[model samples]
Target: MFFDKSHLVALGGNMPSAKGESVETLRAALDRIASSGCELLAVSRFYRTPCFPPGAGPDYVNAAARIACDAAPEAVLNLLHRVEAEFGRERVKRWGQRTLDLDLIGAGDAVLPDAATYQAWHDLAPDAQQSEAPDRLILPHPRMHERAFVLVPLADVAPEWRHPVLGRTVVEMRDALPDDALSEVVAL
Candidate 1:
């Protein structure tokens, strides 16, 4: 059997929403995504990941889901945003605690805009990254390789999914992280 996980979603939240709290919000978001004419092939176990910057707020419930969708990447992103809004998410902060977050991690190994554009965001310095948000979507998620929160759960559902730009499987990226980084994402 062959598994293709090019279309993926990363979910996270640390606050309450119309649906309920972090775990509930994320679960509801998964259902919402499946309702959008897409197939929810698999989902990782929910995880407890510490807030970035250490102590920004409560820990977040994070997970990854593999989906199959025919829509364009931009449309898919819009759908994810709409689902987030339905869960009472507000885009007021760069990376603040949220009621829900649905990220279109990637779609079919396709590079958006171009490889160069993706590279610019991917190479951003940690300080510059804090204040700068890309005006457009950058996929295979620019920072995916460095984030255990994303890679750990992604490995659960799509360990074989390869990064189009980096040419590494999800499991490889997740495994390459330091023990401390991996330790931060604890399965719930």
Candidate 2:
């Protein structure tokens, strides 16, 4: 614990079935976070969706979580990476697949200054596809409003979760969805 602040954390990924970290194995990840002294404020129900960055594989079960922690953003991110590794996450491809994906969705309206700092402080490597840095923690995520996988589950726990940037609610984004890229949520 370093600083008292409320934040939203989004979780996703297929959790490498072959390696054995399945979607249902979330308790272990949560335990790790708890060990780090983070307080669980809220957690979204799991939603299954077709894998994005599409390929031949099982679908992903995604969810969002709202947490309160006293840790610095970088420290919290470091802990998240450790959780992913503990769950056996492998970095073999660009969104190719994963065991667990933990993202620092929002940090009390804090901004990262630039993409390089954003990625570095979080120990994240940019996906060659993304071109620019964002201004804030980029919550409700920059693309979350447009991605059904993110919205459906996000809507479950935070239907009224407002995007600080776009100022739209999760439900609003889901209702405004135009394409079929995001399949409906499958209850787990």
TM-score, every prediction: 0.95, 0.76
lDDT values, one for every candidate: 0.88, 0.66
User: Where in model 1 is the C-alpha error above 4 Å?
Assistant: 1-6
Please write out the lDDT profile of model 1 over residues 11-102, one tens digit for every residue. Answer: 99999988888998888888888888878889999999999768789999999998887777777889899998898888998899899988
The TM-score of candidate 2 is: 0.76
**How high is the lDDT of residue 117 in model 1?**
96
Global Cα lDDT for candidate 1: 0.88
